[model samples]
Target: MTTPLGGAPLTSLEQDPAMAGGDADSGDAGDLGPQPVVNRTIGRRHGHHGRNWMGHGRRAKSNPELRGGFDGLNFHDQRYANGGNQFSVEPPDQGLCVGNGFVMESVNDVLAVYDKSGNELVGPVDLNTFYGYPAAINRSTGAYGPSITDPSCYYDSDTRRWFQVVLTLDRVGTTSSLAGTNHLDIAVSQTANPTGAWNIYHLPVQNNGTQGTPDHGCDGGFCLGDYPHIGADNNAIFLTTNEFALFGSGFYGAQIYAISKKALVHGAASPNVVLFNGGDPNIPAPAFTVWPATSPDGQFAGARGGTEYLLSSDAVFYDSGTSNTLWLWSVSNTRAIDKAPTALNLDVSPLTVQDYAVPTSLVQQKPGDTPLRDCFALTGCAPTYLGYPNIVYPTPRPMAVNDSRMQQVTYANGKLWGTLDTDVLLADGTHGSGINYFVINPHSGGLFANGTLALPDANLTYGAAAVTRSGRGVIAFTVVGPDNYPSAGYASFDAKIGAGDVHIAAAGAGPWDGFTGIPYLAGNRPRWGDYGAAATDGDRIWTASEYIAQTCTLTDYLTAPMFQCGGTRGALGNWATRISKFEL
Candidate 1:
């Protein structure tokens, strides 16, 4: 069974291509002529609170229309391998930060706090509770959350604070059904210690002219701020997101918010925020996810009255046709947010570089589907795992390598660096998935250096990079193909020398056996992690990526462990995450 790219599961309300700006291939924002949007909003301080502990999210079944996969298996996730009630969600998007002795990481909805020595300080807390919201799976009362996805956190040494952001959809009361309204919940730690009290601010992006959000015209309905990211300078904190219709149609450009970092650090009531709308998702050359660059040293470029740089890709799928154009965007006069009259400006210009196209879905090699002859002979899966009714062979699914969008961007060594998933020519001259790592001088808007790292047989996808003050860094991504399972990998880079050879940080134990890609009827595409993360400490860089940690035979999966597959993975999926730090 082969699942088309768009065949991945979607919610019943806004699943139509016509309604959600089509799939990765269809939303070609044709020629968005360089018109920078300028807008402003005065966001009120929602409140500040603390909930250091997080209980497990309930696995109760909700609206099947909101989730997808093999539900008959009673897996929390069905189609797209998305978990409805349980915390066993798919595509462990890695969001991490390492600074001031604390290593903070958030995968999907679970947040884990670790010390610099790799000790788990705070283990597996749900984001709902972290944000002062009601727990999704309340152990005592058995209540749960609406829907929270795409989490990002930053440890700013400039202000000695920890910032965490996530995209949250409005829930209908305390139940599982969605309320069709959404906002960005930004939390700031009062002290350097992240487990302490946190101040929370709510920035609504529905833009239907409600909830203090300006009317940006979201297909005549509320908009969803999908994939919110974080970046900061000495003056402010930048949060960017891709706006999509919550209940209606069309995909808008990237929505950018510039918040006063000082105000948040000082615990001021009602910090100022300037909103930059992506402008008309249906118009020509619509912007996708424009990623903001995080600064590690707190040393920012002192040009154009303090600047916060960003990078974006118009490769094939995002531009409708093939494109080699990379857009360089910046927010000038960012310091003006503190004054009564703000002079913030959004500048978007294109820089030509290596041509890139939509990449192929990653393939994996695992011992899942054996010969039917062996099963009939009772020598293989006939006795335990598959012999049972409703149990079937768990064939490795094709990892969903979503559209070619910009990955993490960072500022270091007076240069802006970033990554993007794109088609590359391998040593064999065949097209394969790889990353285009790039560097820019933000001042002159120049493409200083770049390289496309690819393997002869293996495909590299979901690139994440972090650079120190001296241009020492690593580009982290996942390696998978006909010969390799899903594994965590990285490459070293220096300003003098480009990216080095690919090194396996942690080898995958098995192939991708998640529910999203199981071969049932028209087989589905297992979505790989949507994002990968890397952060800098002093001379070391830390990275977290999705990899298969263990594999079990059919017989061992169903019985003794009571369907947890030897407690190596979730009950339904075979995905795990690995974090590794390299001392340069």
Candidate 2:
């Protein structure tokens, strides 16, 4: 779920405010430009939050017309219940990784471990428990603990270890004033077995405690790191975050933390930390949230050894359909984290891609293949009501395109691969949410191939991609609209065909009505989380997505304030994250 920053419209590409700096040395050997400083203020800390916002839902009528499509594929799906009605909100911000004959999947607050045969071995427990904290405590402390949102994980084959990252936040208004603190919690599995022990570490991100003092890498202490993404190369693990102020008011810039992977895997008491931000002397101007790229084979063996790559879009806000530039950053000397690490802004021709806008309203129709009417109360509309009485008809909420930040990135076969969701103008002149991907030559900073995947009358968003050694890859994503539920699907890709035909991995069981407990919008807003996960296990591609599983759940929306729909609500639904593996 994205923190709403105000209703201000996105600025045009020409008026983008963050584009005012000059180019620095492009991380090539010997160019050895300026090095980033070490931020020693970061270290381990601990606490636990007792209460959390476990969201609510709306009733959805299953539309059969939206049920089945494009099932012809050579892959088999074995999906078990990952997380659903018993836990968090609409879309469970899903995270999954497969390695060493085990599967680890995480939602907002809980994680489940599974064997290679799709059988649960342990967990479905709160993150606090897995992080070695007491389950019940005051959640308002301005200390380090697992707020546990935006969970991302990676499995390193070289070290036979697993790593996961989540944001830790102080309860809103914990201080006398409304200020709070934010932290990043990191965990590295002690062994290949995820059910085993883990080395947990925490780093301070923002502290709004001081009214006017500037925080470590922001204009002030009010900065909060939202939407954290984790990735790794052979030498180091990188975490990228989009920094915002309290209540989601201001956008500062992206923050990158490069930690020594070897140190973490070996249980070092203290690992060196290198922090990068827009304020850094070596970073280019107008930088936003740059996504750190993960190695395709779980190890970095590219032309530039010991280097990690980062990618970002020039557009800051969503619905900005004019930006055409994608920025690339390379950090070298990662293995020597104890010493200075060189950060370079690489020069590359920005790939020319289609611009996009906010998606329109989508409908979850009635059962029996019936079409949904724009107004359910109108005459001759089948099944009188879409879900229940008093439910808003045609609930309007834009699909999650929270900035054009890269969703998932991979480094394979000496090339970089990445994809993101955007509102694109199709060749047929229709505007909808589609997936845009790029394959780039990292050394030359040139685009080898790029394309957009958009279905004729469907909307696609929240996409993740995984590439194999043979240049074969698969993209996993969610599709939803009036003619479809929130379904999970994928498409194969190769150097021969950029992206092939769409195949339905799992069609949603019912309609995704809306979420509860929000302040301003009440029960109509849909929560898609920030992103999904895609990984490769040497020969196969593994993916996960949040899809609607149950359409009707009992919900009490009247318990919250500002809700237009009061009383006990039925037809509320739950999200079941699907994890599937297929050959590419």
Candidate 3:
């Protein structure tokens, strides 16, 4: 998959084409271009007292609005990958001290980084690097404006390291997937300082063409996609990808791949892609399951490992007939993905099969198909309700049979947080708007629908909910639109705790004080488009999006109170400009 360069690559951005206007070496953002200004006003009153996007649902909110800035944090954007396009930051500790953590991102190439701050006196730093094959581009549109997808980040305090995972999409023309051209790339790096020398490692995948096929059919929807995840457990890292193809261009089928973290992080330079048989760690026979020709969409979360469990979200699919009903298979194992002895030993099974209004599926699908089983779906109009847009994390519980959206379950602040995109049909009898959230009591099953926080605003809605391991609060990013055209605009928002309100080991810790700072927005696009996806490491938030020329580029970045969350009034920067540090 490696594309050979014609000559020694241009040593710096100064010499690369498509590199201009902004200074490549200096982090100084240039003059604001011709862009419109939209006034944004955030206040405590706007917060509905922890209520979710919908007033009464599953997830619960303590304090909706948080504070303005965190002290001592830095944001960095790495330029080594596709046009220095990805961004990450090393977050500060609880008391404004530089933290020993780092995160990195990229397109098509695996983006990973490592930093040490609190554990050792090493300088708090941010580092990022990429190792993967480049995309084959169109002579006209230029890789068809290929952008990064499903980007994720992580921190390992024990190893004093940070890791990033991203899917580099490849396309031959303006629309659709490119066969065999798209593959996974993993890059690992070590950070000793915020800016200095670093080591790099690259791993390319070797596929058997059996377990992972870009093509499959579910509910008439053909095998359509892949979202891969990397997790740490038992002192080792694991990698895996979800297999789902669109049947009839609508529904999805399910399948999964679990790679050994030991092989990726500690094994030989070349590692082969491995499949999960079930839950057994002793059997070596390869018998991973493929989506039966009838499942809907297949989705997978990053791998998670611990002394007790190996967890992942296997596939999130909708039944073909109606949009109201949806299903999720939360795959779990007692042993880590790398240690699973046999395919059958892996314990791959669905614990819960949830049901929601058909319209609710519209949240993730946005302006696409509205099936009958969908909870948000109404008779003759658009379906409402939306759920998590990024990736989902798994916990010790096996709720696949009772859960339809695995991305809703997350580990943060040392506790478990769940979000549900509740579909509520208005009394008027027309299918429309609804609620989405984090901080729900999943133990009550989907019946206890409550979110930790809620959006009272009439225009904006929430979905993808992420929480840091601490669980004090979870970060919820917004996806703004159903208007369809990119001209209407879409923005991302974040809410964190206020310094005056934070009280550890006390009840006040969970209440939403309403973010003190102005809500952050992904800069508006000159053309119509949407935010890519979001990820986090407790203290800071990150997201990605694809660009089309003067329109946009799929880019990711870190947003914390300390970083001040750019894209506010007087801020005319692209997502790439707000970065304070660079990893790779």
Candidate 4:
């Protein structure tokens, strides 16, 4: 089922003629103008507790089940359920690519390919095999090689090529510490067919001695690129990463890497790389996780070449104060990347937005269903036939919500669109998790329009959006709370106006898991995945999310048979992914 391809080490920058030039600077690189002030708050409210859960221990005295606010518009339809293989434990970390009448979906370590009709073509294969590496590796010391995680894929219509990227670590056991080498592996399809041979490139990610001195804000001794996101324009491709100290000791800031898209797609032996850090002299303090936005329709309608943009939220932690500013970075002269003695220009700018508080835990409950107090104790009534010890009600313990970060972004129809998870004030005066959608004028650096979408009692988080050439767009996100199971939902909107009412695209079959605490999870919370994905193929928008399977079956925790449950070597059904196609 798998093969071993070993690892590819970083090539010497000097040996590569394309990287001979000195780094470029835009107006003294470090001297950015004064920070952009918040023009005005779009969604403002009071009585916000940083991390409050209203339904933690109390049951409703008497009330009907709460439902989402619907706009009465049904312009979207699910074309097919291209169910993905179960791969990762919690928080599925899903990604999707659809183009040329084909679809490809990837979870943490597994990838699957299908036709437009949802017919399986190839794969359900381990990421290692596809990357030319051993199928399985030693978990403790990483004997065979580093384990692959956090994969993202994109389809480039201009060149008819597909790109897949993943982060590889030395060993699976040392996740909390940066004790071994780390790498970001990139694979570009040689032709339109994804199942055929491909070119693989690896870039070292750890802060080793050879990585050059880090910027002032980076932890020089132990830097690792965590949560790498991918985006692209016609002239170049971008990879944004959150640089962190090996053991999560310090947050360094975001790292943006630019590569030649033309060179990669053409099968060049070695492609030149340009790197940018937010800390240098521009965005000095309180800046982290700069997410790069990719153009959904491929490069903008601009008349210029070699230009790309990135965005970041001033606030990092969920408990941090409400943020009213967004940092923007523009990299120009990217066309010079492959030419020696030429460098790219980088600029950083900050813009003010409406002050928004950090998101709080969402409540999801079924009618007359008492919340499970102790899932491990097996003392509560079960919803599905799986019986007790299943994932507890409200799935994630303590009802924690995702942080406010731009989950996914797209550039289309002369506008940049993005969405993030945030706490919103409902019409009834209740605070709930909701999606914040905002648009920006890339050319003028102005905030175009922004609004919030929240249901009465439901919490929505981990959202993704895509836009069409006609200025029509759709947003896909997860809905969960005390009144509902984790479900996949979406809202469509006309870019000229705003998003329509919420619609449940696909509902979860049951609770995610019965275990309240697990080592892999952060603080024993149910892993709802870092983010979902949405992309447009010019006419139709495709969305994907981590959803629960309709049936229950035992599954391994992570290659260990002893970790099974319910008298099976591997019991406890895990979360699965679903890919759906729709039109606005």
Number of the predicted model whose lDDT against the real structure is largest: 1
Sequence-dependent TM-score of model 2:
0.72
> Candidate 2, residues 342-395: lDDT per residue as tens digits?
542233234544443323223233232101212222342212222222222444
Top candidate, metric TM-score = 1
Per-residue lDDT of candidate 4, residues 1-584 (tens digit): 11112211111110101101111100011212221110101122222755323321112232121121111100010100112111223344777888887888876566778887777787666677777765333333333434566788888887888889987765544232324456789999999888777899887766545545343333445566667888887677888876665532455666788888888998887787777765455554344656676676565534344567667765444335367777666777766767841477877777676565566444443332112222232433222212323343332343335667677877777777888777765544567678777787767778777767677667777888877777777788877766666677777756566666777666765555522133211123334567788777877888886554342222222223222322111122235566667765
TM-score of each: 0.80, 0.72, 0.46, 0.75
lDDT of candidate model 2 versus the reference: 0.56
| Cα lDDT for residue 98, candidate 2 | 83
Off by over 4 Å in 4: 1-88, 136-144, 172-179, 211-220, 301-304, 317-320, 340-342, 365-375, 379-400, 426-430, 514-516, 519-522, 551-573
Q: Counting only residues 3 or more apart in sequence or on different chains, how many pairs clash (N, Cα, C under 3 Å) in candidate 1? A: 11
Q: Rate the local accuracy (lDDT) of all candidates.
A: 0.65, 0.56, 0.26, 0.57
How does residue 267 of candidate 1 score in lDDT? 83
Candidate 1: 10-residue stretch with minimal lDDT? 65-74
For each candidate, C-alpha RMSD in Å? 12.4, 13.6, 16.6, 12.1
Models sorted by TM-score, best on top: 1, 4, 2, 3
The TM-score obtained by model 3 is 0.46
lDDT of 1: 0.65
Candidate 1 lDDT over 295-362, as tens digits, reads 77687766777889888876543323346778888888877879941698888878877766666444
Predictions ranked by lDDT, top down? Answer: 1, 4, 2, 3
Q: Whose lDDT is higher: candidate 2's or candidate 3's?
A: 2
* Model 3 weakest 10-residue run by lDDT: 509-518
Q: Pick the winner on TM-score between candidates 1 and 3.
A: 1
